[model samples]
Target chain A: MSGPAGGGRAGSVLALVGNISARSLRVWQRNRDVYFVTWKTNLVPPLLEPILYLLAFGAGIGALVSEVQYRGEMIGYTTFIAPGLLATQVMFQAFFETTYNTFVRMYYQRTFDSIMTTPLTLEDVMAGELLWGASKGVIGCAVMMVALSAFGLLRYPHALVIIPFSFLAGLLFAGLGLCFTGIVPQIDSFNFPTFLFVMPMFLFSGTFFPLDVLPRWAQVLAEALPLTHVANLMREAALGRLPADLLRDLLYLAVATIPLCVAGIHLMRRRLVK
Target chain B: MSPVIEARALTKRYGGLAAVDGVEFSIRAGECFGFLGPNGAGKTTTVRMIYCASPVTAGDLRVFGIEVGDRPREIKARIGVCQQEDTLDPDFSVRKNLTVFARYFGIPAARAEERSRELLEFMGLWERKDARIRELSGGMKRRLAIARALINDPDLLILDEPTTGLDPQSRHQVWDRVRGLRRQGKTILLTTHYMDEAQTLCDRLVIMDHGKILVEGPPVDLVRSRVGKEVVEVEGYPPGLVQHARQSGWTFESDTGRLFIYTDSGEAVFTVIAHQFPSERCTVRTAGLEDLFLKLTGRELRE
Candidate 1:
């Protein structure tokens, strides 16, 4: 209903569409059945945590900060932080799906091995995983939108574009996560990538604050992060305005997906195919 | 009859070491052929290559007369594989596991549902079709795996160590299903260390050690040709006794820490062994695949 699945399905185009088929959707449907059992637990971190962050920082701390300048208007601090949280929620959901969930299914649970014995190729499995991760990201984004609106922070209906945007962002992280999954020899090794790469991006990519507030050198560094583009795009959607550099932001996202998805399938094939 | 599976000098190597080395064999249509081996004897590796889980490092391998390397998916589409390890999905219930796997083979959803029902009922899992995989007993899990393998009603069924961890009751249950399947004329290829299971289910088998076939024939013929009709064991005997038996013209083998006397005349060998060795140390029994297995693969433990 939130159009997240469109983004999720679209996520597979860059990762070798020739190798994927309608057969891959069966993998998505398999995960859908599993989702019925675990949906409550799956929604908790992405849905609840954002509200808690909104209450603590938006209301509790927004009372101290007077005014944050927006496009020709002085917006409350809660309004500024709300869209950033949406982008972060999508990223985290997709990351979890493609990394820990995929690893458990592939290694410990052997679900992928079970499927591979049939007519489905390894490429179908990877495409299915990417679509599933994107779907989760879309759901998280939509759920966070409802939560933001409930807090009386969401400004306009046009902000719903963030759902599809979040879906693309979800695919981005999922592709990167799968690349990690393909090479990881042990589960504990995931800590290195998350701590060094993911956590730094979360903190420094303008998620909690605007990048301009930091030093010029820090702002320049932030420009390189995908999350910075996501945060800016979500902010534009929330304010019912489009950024002049929207084409550049979208191009950057589209270009990044090509390599990340290709690498994801290639790396996973290295580990999967004998 | 034409061959369902044919391997000519097939080989599988991991790094510099060969796991399945230049193995050659052929399975006839509508017959249960088995691969008998000990741990690390390359039984699993050979089956893996046949199932296309691992590539053949050298030589020719074909399933249903189709080259495995050139058309693996086409070959995989027609064969059902019950792998050595339990790879059933814990996320799914018994019925869902089979049904979802059917989808991977491109079975329509409605047909998948019907086939799952039939397979569950056939495997005696109809009553427990709704149970989660984690809740099933080990034997039940194996049965469900077998049922899943049959969902597509494959032309060739490959079972790898199907009853390794099973109890006697469970083993019989699986064997009964296998026998029923054989009666229906399914072409089956299996690998196992259980000599009795092989002797019971296999019409033909090959005993393998160190990646090579040591003996291949029908069970009864293999036993008669390799170890004669009967065997006598003289336990705790000194080498002098073995040498004495050798000098006296008794056909015997001096194996690791045991003296095995093989002969067509068990009565004669038993009488002599009972007299020379202590009564507790001598015994006689019919020769079978286990003796050939131990003789060919040795008694050393394999990791």
Candidate 2:
């Protein structure tokens, strides 16, 4: 490598991230392409969990509440809960990459220390990591979204918007993923947070049922969780029928995402440099 | 031209203990300066401050005449550092490793490619350009690290113990490359505990012990000034050698019974050693940097 003897602005902070991210993406695809294919290979199995629930819980239990009406319309039980499952997968995959993968690169691999010795500063490091997380999340969510659409569960005429909404929903989880990485000392610490935070959200974030179906007090608690807002916003956007409380849900998730991201970046800088 | 590196009272403290105490030193343009110290003598700490990786705890430190206390990036941009540890990315090939590091300094892609090839060839790794980092040998890795540090055509190069772990063959190869750079008039600041390496590569050096400077000067001059013109080294531990020499009207210091008797008459000293200590193993030798270091720092190992 030659020194910046003929120095250029191309090595500016922003340019460095863009260049490294571009190179890293190629490395990721070549090295981690197997991981993507492996996740895809097993993806068929995960889809079965929600499909079985819809068939058994929706079809089997629809007989009891066979004729529920809302807004002068009658909807099938399976149709009501399928979108929630899709959003749950987005949260799951996004958070999984952000926590375990990021923790390894940050602590175990010592990759940031190598980069920091270059012209790139701490901010560029954080940006590059976040960009990687977002790209991974987008890939996983896009795959699942296509699979869900194939099942004839949801429809969107403006299908391109689904990509951005999925990215935003994935980013919200990515932010929280980094926040968890900052405090957890080891990869093992990730398991408890996943069990405590991720598992509960997958179970209780109105994924398997409507929020109104819960008791009033339980409904209030669920509303404050970011995943619930993400699931609600996504279900509305995918179905092309904005919910009555759509503004509130979207605003709540937007607020939560910004602070979580800022906090995560702050903690990462402190941890890496320390 | 400005001094290549400058520092005043630079110190680094690990909690309460100072690894590098109030040390002050500087190097001017195109000079090969070295820090000769035993392990834990804070040579590594001093090198880090010049490279602007480790923070200065209390004193002023500058690189390329820029105050590293505030403008580290500006200082770092003009210089290159090869840290003590191997931090190369294992996933990258030899060629990609150099090119990627160049890009981090904002070198253009096309220019970076040309430089990477030139450096890989210079370090005798062009044949292994496509090899992964894990596939390279220890010596190859060290050469690559040195090559990578030079990629930016840095005004100053800071090497922290460049050849400590290499075998003799690899060490000689590295020494040749470093000597080639020195001939190009690139200022180099090096730190090593190996006395031979400091003696061979450095024009002037400072011997540090316990975060303090014990002595500093050109290698040969430092030896001549400290230990006289010549030294008679009697290898085996001599019985009462210090007393024997002093009583014999000669000046000497005994290190674990190895007598280093300094005098202008080297042949006369050996004659006296052979006659006085017939059972003791003896080898007469001219004084060099090692004797000078032993004299200043003593023979005891520092941790």
Candidate 3:
């Protein structure tokens, strides 16, 4: 085979896409089988996380504060943060799945090495991982939505759209997490991204409060985070308000997901295809 | 009628160093072939190229009459590989491992189940089909790896040190199953540092060191040609015996505390050494593949 110098940029990308086959779904199937085996433990976290956040921040913290102004309307603090919790769930589920879980499979378990010996290529394995990571996000969002809706924190049919939206948001964060997984020297190196990237997004993605409260520079920085758009979309959907800015948020996520996913696959191929 | 695998000047280079430097060999359809070498001797690298797990740096490599680089998926689908490392899925049980691996080959679920049962039975893992991976012993895990490799009923099986870490009983068990596969007309390619394993399993073998083949032939022929009919070992270094052996133009090697002398007639050499060095201990035994291996590769620790 010719080295990287022989193939042009577009040609190599086309070749990469061409190498991916339906066999990738087998990787997804493998992960799904494993998830089901310990599903009892898996279900507990997503189900209770949103409720705890609602009780602590919504009931306890919301009791002291009056109605918060969101989208120029007075709304309960619990209602305000419910959609943000859904957005964070999407982020956490996909990120953790692709980062820690994928690393273990690739490095420790040698799962990727085993799969490569079959008809499946590295590209197929990464594609399957991205899809599976996104699927985890979708599953977590569904469970959290059920818990949030029980407390009357979510609107009817509009809130249902968050399930599908979570998949897209999931792909974005999964891709982002996989990029880090590719570059990190070891498992312990994940602490860098977890603290510097994920923790900041968790607290400042307008999850607990509106972005208007932050400093002007900080508000712009928050808007740049992928979780910010995810939270904005979830909040609008939960409140049953179909704002025109919905397309802007959707377009931003859709556009960002493709490159990050592609780059994630590319970086992983460099690590694996040696 | 054609060879199952062919490599002409096969080379695999990582950065400035070449792991497999211009090696050439071909494997026939039904014979059991082996690449014998020490650690970092490029045995695993050569097999990796044949199975398309690693990209060849420069070579004309073909498997099943197809260029490996052009259509790896086609080559890989028909070839089963048991890598040197334990690549079995720790998440699945004995049976699920085979069934899940079958999905990668596009094997239908019904067929996968049927094949899984057949393989587990063949490998003697049927009883532990539902047991978790961690619960199984090391031998069981290796057997399960072999069973998983056979899920596709591949025409050629490539095993890289299949019994490296197994106990003697476990190693013999794996060897028996491998021989069984060969009896069914499946071609096999194996690489191992264990000379006895190669002597037992390989029909045609090559001794490799520093990524180059030193010798290639059947095990018995290699021993007879490189290491004569028998070997005489004396317990300690006897300088007079060594001088006499050299002056007589005998083929021998000396180490710190032992001396090995090779001869066609074990009794003659043993009698002479015993007569000359009455106090020195000596034993004459038939030469084997290990003698030829050490003679060719030298007895040095490889990292």
Candidate 4:
């Protein structure tokens, strides 16, 4: 963050990586202000989407497949899918918040362009968007929690720890979605992310069934997805105890978050600053 | 003291199309300077560079004696920009818009609230302070945009065609607020194709065409130098009118139906010129900025 001095260019760009400034909070404040006015209308899909899936799949389909083999124990079908749907709720909420909503701010509203005229840099704006998106994802998880508790699927009191992990899941998906938005040329191209990437991740991330039920190569393919890591961690957390690979899961989540977030800012700055 | 903003060989290119090319000028403090041009003349592009909204492809631009190509955040802190289109926060009310904008400049909560109140009143938006953005009319939205730009009480204000879509009353109201800002000694830069607006508001202006500046001076001086003092319009061109003017050493610009002859004192020359045409053909009036504008930019329509 050096100023442009007499005979040299300003500080090199790499030196400014992860340079989240206090100004980013102002952007978050702006979005938060707007959210208060529109939150009711905004919460409908996130709250209802999972519950619909729960009643339709958990009650309707669970009667057919009453239980899933979990390690050495057999868990009720509703309990098996509850944590997975929680991950899906975070995915949908974080994805929509960053892609559709963030794109509207950047392109349609041109709010990002308006903010660019102010002292806040592009990095600040992107960081603020990421945080706001993650927050929206957490709200979605809350909606899922209410649904889970109401259905008696939250049998483990320690499943509450999954609430904290929900925030990390939100950040991960928000990072992926915003990074896609940084270089996408048009609004219609947004369908590619939803259909090609996000939709596939939602379907193949072991939300409906155990990955082990698939053949060896198909299971390997599912393991490579970002949602699979979050789903596995969330399922273990919802089972009332931290798994042995807790450290590894945390490390993977960090690896997923920091790089995508930095790259998203860099690409978005190219769209904005010029 | 040095000027508030200076541009030397400032260039901006979009691929092979040079939107702003080697433009040079300086804006003195406590004066209203304007960039006057028809559409696509690079007025907005040049001002966007000044406000750090656009990057400079080449050349030097300095704001408050700081290089504008870099140090964007520093320069941005001191200047306020009201863009051409309305970019108000649709979610916030009239008052909240200013309050939120003040926060961007890092104004504390107390100060931001105070300024929001004052600016809403100043822009005559206080009565509808709680109205959503969609509830406001076009004029009210424009007024709110101006108030938002003033949130930080910036030293240098930039308005890009602020009165373009405004009605006569709304336009006058905005002009009054701008005049009030000028009285406070704020350095103002604006772009307008309206000749009367430029003459009424700008202390000095640069007339641009095709990304190049054609003339730079005070409005009155530009009118005097380029367009003389009087103009005579004839309804139709008589035979050999072009040759006749050339032989008489007088200059005239002609359109499809009318001919405009320029002169410092048109009564004497107009009488001689009018007699050559029909008696109902000629009319004489004072030359103005519009005449000079047309003279410089030509009569062709530019989209």
lDDT tens digits, residue span B120-209, model 4: 888888999999999998888888998888887888999999999889988998899899988888889999999989999999999998
Error of 3 at A82 (Å): 0.4
Chain A TM-score across all models, in listed order: 0.90, 0.77, 0.97, 0.92
Docking class of 4: medium
- The digit string of per-residue lDDT tens for model 2 on A1-274 reads 1112343644432333332334333333322433543565646634565667666766788667654343356665556566677677678767877788777666665666666666655556665556556666666656666666776767776444556766777778878898888888788999988998889888788776676768999888888787888777766666678656878876776787766766676677657642
| Candidate with the greatest DockQ versus the true structure | 3
Instruction: Give candidate 2's error at residue A29 in angstroms.
Output: 12
Q: Mark the regions of model 3 whose C-alpha exceeds 4 Å error after superposition.
A: A2-5
Better model by DockQ, 2 or 4?
4
Query: Which pairs of residues collide in model 4?
Result: none
TM-score of chain A of 2: 0.77
Write candidate 1's Cα lDDT for A177-196 as tens digits: 99999999988888988898
Runs off by more than 4 Å, candidate 4: A1-19, A155-157
What's model 2's overall lDDT? 0.75
Off by over 4 Å in 1: A1-18, A70-73, B255-257, B275-280
Error of 4 at A214 (Å): 0.7
DockQ of each: 0.37, 0.22, 0.76, 0.56
lDDT of 4 by residue, A106-147 (tens): 888889878878998777888889888888878888877887
TM-score for each prediction? 0.94, 0.83, 0.98, 0.95
Chain B TM-score per candidate, please: 0.95, 0.95, 0.98, 0.97
Instruction: Name the TM-score of chain A in model 3.
Output: 0.97
How well does candidate 3 match the true structure in TM-score terms? Answer: 0.98
lDDT of 2 at B147: 90
Q: Between prediction 3 and prediction 4, which has the larger DockQ? A: 3
